[model samples]
Structures are given as structure tokens and as C-alpha cells.
Target: MAIRNCLVTGAGSGIGAAVAELLSGQGHRVALAGRREEPLRELSARLPGPSLVLPTDVTRPEDIESMFAACEESWGPVEVLVHSAGAGDSARLESTTDTMWDRQLELNLTAPFRCVRRAVPAMRKAGFGRIVVVASVASKVGAPYVSAYTAAKHGVLGLVRSAAAELADTGVTVNAVCPGYVDTPMTDRSVASIAAHTGRDADGIRAKLAAAQPIGRLILPGEVAAVIGLLVQEEALNGQSLMVDGGSVQS
Candidate 1:
């Protein structure tokens, strides 16, 4: 694989961290972008190859622009962009406030769009690019009490498909990775929330969620990162949603 500059949003933890670490290990110049500076710095220190930490809130367009600018100044044009900067919500439709809906859309759907729009120009100039959007299994299947998150993820898939079509033959590929119940800080929080809501022990709630998957366990961050890595390969893979859900979504 040709050495390239890669930008990973939400690279501070979870799937984003794994993807950034993996890409750095594979000899790619990785730019880690996230709202938190501490983890980004830590990851930069730990990862191999050249790495840059651009602390950014993906919801802000200026921040996204600055992140790309920093990457270009430090490395070169961004050859790969992995958008994993998103938030999860669990509120029923009747209980979902307008603020919650807006927040979910801003973080999950609009933010990735802004990041990609900023990066696409440089990618077009280079005539080669790989964009991977981190969606969720909820995008395809209905999960109770998380309508806002599911809607945002569905929008993300739509964005990927539309952008992929527009960038086809332009050497730019756009795709989405839908992960289910990964063992991350986010998942930990979700488990705690479930425990509180159902008055069950944390272990019991976790076990129930894990058993919900056909694999009988929660997915791992590295497992999802591996799928992102595959999408970034030189092969022409675009407008596809690869689910890393432990067989939760068989479609």
C-alpha cells in the first residue's frame, strides 16, 4: 500500500482510536481529530509513524476546516478520512426534546457532512480518497427509545450513498460502517443507563444486551476498525454499509 495521510475524527477513544492506531501502525501519516486533547495527545505519543493531534469539535465547520488545514500543513493532502465523531442517544419519540433531536443530528449526521465537504476538495485535487462514515445498526433496524440516533444514522447512510455517487469516477469512495454494541466507553455508559432504567444490575443488563446478538457477545473496537481498514484499501468500494454487529443484522 502506498503511504498516505489519514485523518480520523473522534480518534480519542473506542473505534476511532483503534482505527487511528491501526492506520498509524500500517505506515500512514495519521491526523487524530477529536474534541478532547488529552487522549489525542496520548494516542499521538503511542502510535507509530508520523501523527498529528488536532483537537476539534466535529460539529463546528471552522474546527473541521482547521483540522484539515493542520493536517495539510503538517503532512500533505488528506488521502483518507474516517468520520467516527458521533454521539448516541436513547430517548423515546414522545420524550425526545427538540434540543435532543437537533443535537443528535448535528453530531451524527451534519458533522460528518461538514468534515467530508471540507476534505473533499483536497481529495479531488489529489484524485484519490477514501471516506468511511461510522454509522450504527440502529440505522437499519428499529430500536426502542433511540429514535433520534437511529434517524441521524439513517441520514448518514443516505449521505454516504449520495456522496459516493457524486464522487464516483473521481477516485473518491464513500462508505459507512455500522457497528453494534461495541465494548467502548460509550457502550459502558449505555449499559449503566439500561441498568438504571430497568433496575437491573449492570452485569445483568450487559449480559442481556450481549445475548441479543447472535454471536452471544459484544463486538470489539478492533473488529469494527478492521472493516474500516478494508474500506480504505485501493479497491473500488463505495456506497456500501458494512455491518460489524456480531450477526445482529443479517440483512
Candidate 2:
């Protein structure tokens, strides 16, 4: 395998951290971008190959620009882009405030769009690039609450599909990995939030989330990372949303 220059957002923990480990272990040069410098620095220390720890908030356009500029300066153009920076919030549509809606769209939808726009021209010029979005089962289907999050995810999926088609002939493939309830810190937060609101035991809420997956357990971060590794290596799999939910939502 070629040692590509890869950039991954949300690299402090969860899916992004897993992807960083997998790609770096394979000897790729990785640029880790996240809001926290300490975690990214720690992850960079443990990576097997070359890496840059960039403290960035993807929601800010200036921060995104600086991230890419730094990557270009350190390495060359990014050969692989893994956008795993996202968050989930649960609230009924009626109760969801404008701030909540905007935050969801900014982080989950618009941020990736900006990153893709910034990365694609260089990718098209290189004539070989991979863009993978770590989406969620919420990207494909709906739930009772989490309306804002679901909407943002669904919109991002649409973005992935449209961009994949547009860049299909440029040797740049765009795809998504939509996993169900993954065992990550994000899910932990979700469980805590639900417990606080409903006055239920956190463990029970977590158990319920696990059972929602067809496999009767939460998906592992490494499992999702493996799928991302596949997407990054394969050039034929464009405009595809590979579901990693253990047979849930077989689309």
C-alpha cells in the first residue's frame, strides 16, 4: 500500500482516534485535527508514523483553513480525508431551539462540506484521493428524538452522494460509514443526557441503546475504523454509504 498523507478531524477520541491509529499503523502520514491540543498531542505521540497534531475547531472557517495550510506545509496535499468530527443531541423538533439546530448543522453538516470543498481541488489535481465521512445510522433512518442531529446527518449523507457523483471521474471517491450506536465517548454522553432527562438509570439507557442494534451490542470503535480503512484504500467504492450496524437498515 502507498503511504498517503491523511488528515482526520475529531482525532482526540472515538472514531477519529481509531482511524488515526489504523492509518498510522499502516505507515501513513496523518494530520490529527480537533478542538483539544492535549489529546491530539497524546494521540500523535502514540501513532506509528509521521503525524501533525492540529488544534482546530472545524466549525470555524478560519480554523479549517489553518488546518489545511498546516498540513500542506508539513506534508503535501492531503491524499485521504476522514471527517469524523460530529456530535449528537436529542430533542423533539418542537422543543429544539434555533441554537441547537444551528449547532447541529454547523458541526455535522456544514463543517464537512467546507472541509471537502477545501480538499477536493487538490484531490482532483492529484487524481487519486479518498474522502470518508463517519456518519451514523441516524443518517439513514429516523428516531423519536434527536431531530436536529438526524436532519444534519441526513443532509450530510446527501452531500456525500452528490459530491461522489460529481467527482467520480476525477479519481477522487467520496463515501460514508454509517454505524449504529457505537461504543464511544459520544454514546456515553448520550446515555448520561437521556438518564438525566428521563430519570432513568444510565446503565439501563445504555443497555437499551445496545439492544437497538441488531447484533444486540454496541458497535466498537475499531470496527468502524476498519471500515474507514477499507474506504480509504478502495477507489471503486464511491457514492456508497457502508452501513456498519450489524444488519440494521439493510439499504
Candidate 3:
């Protein structure tokens, strides 16, 4: 495998950290972007290959620019991009506030749009690149009690598909990976929040979430990471939203 210069957003933890570490292990130079510096710094030191720690809030256009600039400066053009920075809430539309609606869209949908602007140009110039958006099962199907989350993630799929169409003939491929009930820190928080709201124990809520997957368990972060690694190298798999939900949202 060629030593591609890759940039992964939300690299401090969850799917982003998993993808970044896996890419680094595959001999790629990774640029880690996240709000927290300490975790990125720690992950960078532990990576198998060289990495740049660019503590960035992906929602900010200026931060996105600086992140790409820093990565290019250190490792040349970024040949691969993984967008995993996302946040959402579990609220019905009637109960959702303006802040909740906007933040979900901004973080889950708009940030990828912003990051791709920085990536596509560099990728187009080089005539080779890969872009993967870490979307959700909510993007594919409707789930109750998380209207804002579902909307934003559905928007993410739209963005990914549109970008994929436009860049089809180009070497730059855009796609999405939709995961369901992953075993990560973020999911732990979600489980806790659901428990608080429903007056159920965390274990029960977790079991319910896991049972949503036909495989009867939570998906591992590394399982999703493995698919991302393949997408980065598989030129033919473009304009796709590969679901890693253990058959939770099968089409």
C-alpha cells in the first residue's frame, strides 16, 4: 500500500480514533483533528506511523482550513479524508429546541461539507483520493425519539451521495459508513442519557440498543475501522453508503 497522507476528523475518540489508528497502522501519515488536544496528542504518540495533531473544531471553516493547511505543510497533500466528527440528541421533534436542531445539523451534516471543500481540491489536483463520512443507521432509516439526529444524519447521506456523483469520474471517491450501536465512549453516554430519560437501568437500555442489531450485540469500533481501511484503498467502491449496522437497517 502507498503511504497516503490522510486526515481524520474527530480523531480523539470513537470511530475517528479507530479509523485514524488503523490507517496509521497501514503505513499512512495521519493528521488527527478534534476539539481536545491531549487525547489527540496521546493517540499520535501511540500510532504506528507519523501523525500530525491538529486540534480543530470541524464546524469552524477557519479551523478546517488551518487543519488542512497544517496537514499539507507537514505531509504534503492529503490523499485520504475521513470525517467522523458528529453529535446529536435523542429528542422528539416536538420537544427539540432550536439549539438542538441547529447543533445536530452543524456538527453531523455541515462539518463534513466544510471539510470536503478542503479535501476535494487537493485530491483533484493529485488525481487520487478517498473520502469517507461516518454517518449513522439513522441516516438510512427512521428511529423514534431522535428526530434531529435522524434529520441531520439523513442530510449527511444526501451530501455524501451528491459529492460522490459529482466526483465520480475523478479519482476522488466520496462515500458514507453508517454504523448502528457501536461500542464506544459516545455510545456509553447515549446509553446513560436514554436511561435517565426513560427511567430504565443503563444495562437494560444498552441491551435494547444492542438487540436492535440482528447480530444481538454492539458493533466494535475496530469493526467499522476495518471497512474504512478498505474504502480508502478500494477505488471501485464509490458513490456508496456502506452500512455496518449488523443488519439493523438493511435495504
Candidate 4:
């Protein structure tokens, strides 16, 4: 396998951190980008290979440019990009505000879109690149009380497919990994939100979520990272939204 320059957003923790760790172990130079500098630096210190800790807010275009510039300055253009920075909040459709809707779109859909836009040009010139967006199973299916999140995920999956088609002849492949109820801090927050909204026990909500997957357990962040590792290594897998859920959506 080639040791490429990789950039992973949301690398402070969860799926992003796992992906960064896996790539670094495989001898890739990784750039850790996240909002918090401490965690990024902490992750960089532990990585097996070279790394750059870049604090960035993906919601800001200027910050995105700065992140790419820093990566370019350190190890050259990003040959592999994994966008795992996202958040989800639950609300009934009627109660979902414009702020909530926009936030979801910005974080989940627009940020990845911009990062791909920034990376693809160089990838086309080099004729080799891998881009993976850590999407959710919500990208595939609709559920109650998460209309905004579902819409954003669906749009991001569409973005992946369209971008992949456009870049079919290029060496760059665009794809998304859709995992269900991953055991991450994000899911922890989801559990809290659901419990607060429904006046249910948080532990019970979590158990219900785990059982939602046929495997009857929350998906592990490393499991999703392994799937991302596969996408990064395989050039033939483009424009596919792979389901990392335990056979929940059999697509």
C-alpha cells in the first residue's frame, strides 16, 4: 500500500480518531483536524507516523482553506480525505427550526462537499485519491424525530454518488460509510436527547438503540474505521454508500 498524505476531520475522537489511528499505523502521514486543539494534539502524539494537529471549524470556509493550506505546507496535497465531523439532534418535524436544519446541512453535507471540492482538483492531477464521508444509516432510511438529520445525510449520500460519477475517469474515488448507532460520544448525546424529549430512562433508550441493530449492540467506532480503511485502500469502490450497521438496511 502507498503511504499517502491523509487528512481526517473530527480526528479528536470517535470514528475520526479511529480512522486517523488506522491510517497512521499503516504508515500514512496524517493531518488531524478538529475544533479542539488539545485532542488533536493528543491524537497526534499517539499516532505511529508523522502528523499535523490542525484546529479547524469545518463550518467556516476560511478555516477549511487554512486546514488544506496547512496540510499542503506540511506533506503536500491530501491524497486521502476522511470527513467524520458531524452532529445529530432530535426534534419533531414541527419543532425543527431553521437553525437546526441549517446546522445539520452545514456540518454533515456542506462541510464534506467543500472538503471534496478542495481535495479533488489535486487528486485529479495526481490521478490517485480516496475520499470517504462518515455518514450515518440515516442516509439510507428515515426515522422519527430526526427529519433535519435524515435530510442532510440523504443529501450527502447524493453528493457522494454525483461526485463519484463526475470523477469516474479520474483516479479519485468518492464514497460514504453509513453506520448505525455507533458507540461514540455523538450517540451518547443522542441518547440523552431522546431521553429528555420522551421522558424515558437514558439507559433504556440506549438499550433500545442497540437492539435497533440486528446484532443487538451498538456499532463500534473501530468497526466503522475498518470499513473506511477498506475504502481508502480499494480504488474500485467509488460512489458507494456502504452500510456499516449490523444488517439493518440490507442494500
Candidate 5:
């Protein structure tokens, strides 16, 4: 297999970092872009393959644009884009401020759209590309206290499907991976927040989330990355939402 020129957003931590590491291990030319530089640099150092540490704020359009430009300059046109920079918050409808809702959409949905926008022209010109958006289980099923997050993820799924359909004739593929309760820093904070609010131990809260999945364990970050890896190589799975939610979602 050719070593793809890949760009992973949120590569400083969690699923993003895991994806970057996994791809780099497979000898891909990976660029790590995130809000923090230190972790990106640290992860880059750990990789056997060469990597670019691009500190980027995905929510800022200018930053996102510059990050991709820098990535292309360093590694060539990104043949694969893993949009892993996202966040989810627990806020019931009544308590979900408009600002919070807008920001969630900005980071989780709009950012990926913009990234894809910049990536596709090059991808089309080159004739091969793979784009994966890291969505959440909230995109498929509804949960309380995360209406805004659910809405944003839902939007991302829509974008994936629509874009995939548009590019079906092209060599590029667009897809999404929806994972449930992954054992990442985001889930750690979620567990802690629920524990503090409900007077339960964080471990107990984490266990509950794990139990909600049929597999009865927190999803591993590598598990999600492996799915992305498969999609990047796959020729037939375009426009799909591959679920890595421990069998909680079937379809």
C-alpha cells in the first residue's frame, strides 16, 4: 500500500492522537493538527514515520485553512483527512444556552465541513482521497442532557452522506465513524462531571456508560482508529456510518 499523506485534526489527544499514531505506525505521512502543540509534538516524536505538528484551532476558519495549507506544504496534498477534533457537552434543553449550541455546531459540524471543502478540490484533482468524520452515537440515538451535541453530530452525519453521494463517481470516499462511550479524555471528563453532579463515583458512572453498550466495556480509541484505517483502504464502503459502539447500534 502507498503511504498516504494524511491529516488528523485533534491529534493532540484522544481518538485523534490514536488515529495519527496508528496511521503513522503503518508508515503514512501523517500531519498532527490540534489546539495544543506540546502533545502533537510529543506524539510526532513517538511515531516512526515523519510527521508535522500543526497547532490549529479548528473552530477558527482561518486557522483551519492555514493548518491544511501548512500540512500540504510539508507533506503534499492530504490524501486522507480524519476529522477527529470534536467535543460533546451535557446540557438539557432548558439549560443549553444558544452560545453553547452554536459553538458545538461550529466545532463539531461546521469545522469538518470547512476542512472537507478545502480538501476535496485537491482530492478530485489528484483522483484519490478518503475523508472520515468522527461522529458520536448521539448521532443515531437520542440521549438526555445533550441535545445540542446530538444536533451537531446529526449534522455531521448528514454532511457525510451528502458529500459521499456527491462524490460517488469520483475516486474519493466520505464516511463517518460513530462510537459509543469511548475511553478517551472526553469520556473521562464526562464521567467526572456526572459523578460530581450526582454524588456517584466516577468509576461507577463509567461502568454505567460501558454497560449501556452491549459489549459491556468502554470502546478503545484504537478501535475507532482501526475502523478509520479500514475505510481509508476500502473501495466499497463510501457514504457509510461505520458504528464502533460495542454492538449497541446495528445497521
Candidate 6:
């Protein structure tokens, strides 16, 4: 296996953190990017090898450019780019404000676009790169009260597929990992929202969500990270949206 210079966005927590840590452990030089500087610094300090912490807001083009520049300066050009920065919003169409929709789209869809756009030049130059977009199960299944998030994720899948096709013959691969309910801080917030909306206890709501999945539990962050690790392998997997939803949606 090659020692990749990897850049993982939203690496301060959840699946992003797991992916960054795992890649770092595997002897890859990883650059952690996120809004929270403290967590990114802490993760960098704990990881093996030289890990760079680029505290950045993915929604900003300048910030994205700065992060990639810093990564390149510290660890050379990024051979692996994992776009795991996203946010979910729970709101019905009638209740969702234009601002909320725009915000979600900016963070969930356009942020990845910016990152990918910035990475493509370097990747093409190297002629060997791996790109992974972290989408969601909502991309496949339309869930209620999350129209904006679902729409953004669907767009992400489309973007990944298009990029994959464009780079098929090149030594680069573009793919997406669509995860179901992962047990992360975001899941906790979702549980709280459900409880508040339905007047149920947090544990009860969590139980209901778990039972909704075929596996009878929320997916772990490490589980999703494992799928990401597999996607970056030097194989023929391209333009595929691999679901890590524990049999939630069979696609």
C-alpha cells in the first residue's frame, strides 16, 4: 500500500475523525480540516506521523483553498481527499425557510464541490488520486421533514457519479459513501429533536430509530470509516455510491 497524503474534511469528529485516525494509523500523512480548531489540533496531536490541522469552514471557497494549500505545503499534494463535511436539517417544506435551505445546500453540497474543484488540478497533475464524498441514505430514500438535506445529498451523489465518469480512465477514482443513521453527535441531536417533537423520552426515541433499521441499532462511526478506507484502495471501484446503512435501503 502506498503512503498517501490524505486530506479529510470535518475530521474533528464522527466518521471524519474515525477516517482521519485510521488513515493516520496506517502511516499516511493526514490533514484534518474543520471549523473547530481545538478538536482538529487535538486529533492531529494524537495521530501518528505528521498530521496537519487546517481549521477551515468548508462553505468558504477561500478557506477551502487555504486548507489545501496548507496541506500541500506540509505533506505534498493530497493523494486522497475525503469530503465528510455536511449538516442535516429537519424541517418540512412549508416550515423550511429559504435561508435554511440555502445554508444546507451550501454546506452539504457546494462545500464538497469547492473541495473537489480545488483538488482536481493537483490530482490530475499527480495522475493518481482518490476522492470520497460522504453522502447519506437520504440521497436514496426520501424521508419526511428533511427535504433540503435529502436534496443536497442527492446532488452530491450526482456530482460524485459525474466526476467518476470523467476520471474513469485516469488513475483517479471518485465515489460516495452513503451512510444511514450513524451514532454520532448529529444522531444525538436528531434523537433530541424527535423526543421534543413527539413528547417522548430521548431513550425511547433512540430506541424507535434503532428499531427502524434492520440491524436494530444505529451504525457506528468506525463502520462508516471502514467503508471509506476501502473506497480509497487501488481498485476499480468508481462512480459507485456504496451504502453503509446496515440494510436500511437496499439499492
Model 6: how far is 6 from its true place, Å? 0.4
lDDT of each: 0.91, 0.95, 0.91, 0.95, 0.92, 0.91
Q: Give the lDDT of residue 230 in candidate 2.
A: 94
Error of 1 at 144 (Å): 0.2
lDDT of 6 by residue, 1-251 (tens): 78999999999999999999889888999999999999999898899877888999999888998999898887789899999988888877899999989999999999999898889888888789999999999889898999999999999999999999998877889999999988998889998887787788999888888877799999999999999999999559999999998898998
Deviating ranges (above 4 Å) for candidate 5: none
What would the per-residue lDDT of candidate 4 be over residues 178-234, giving only the tens digit for each residue?
999999999899988888878999999999999999999999999999999999999
lDDT of 3 by residue, 153-204 (tens): 9998999999999998888899899999999888999998888888999998
Q: lDDT by residue for model 1 over 180-216, one digit each (tens)? A: 8888989999988777877889998889888887899
- Candidates' TM-scores? 0.97, 0.99, 0.98, 0.99, 0.98, 0.98
Give the CA lDDT, 0 to 100, for residue 114 in model 3: 88
Error of 1 at 240 (Å): 0.4
* Residues 66-169 of candidate 2: C-alpha lDDT, one tens digit per residue: 99999999999999999999998888779999999999999999999999999999999989999999989999999988999999999999999999999999
lDDT tens readout by residue for model 5, 78-165: 9999999998878668999999999999999999999999999999998899999999998898899999999999999999999999
What does the lDDT come to for candidate 5?
A: 0.92
Which candidate, 3 or 4, has the higher lDDT?
Answer: 4
Runs with alpha carbons beyond 4 Å of true place in candidate 2: none
Cα RMSD for predicted model 5: 0.9
Model 2 / residue 3 / CA error / Å: 0.8
Off by over 4 Å in 3: none
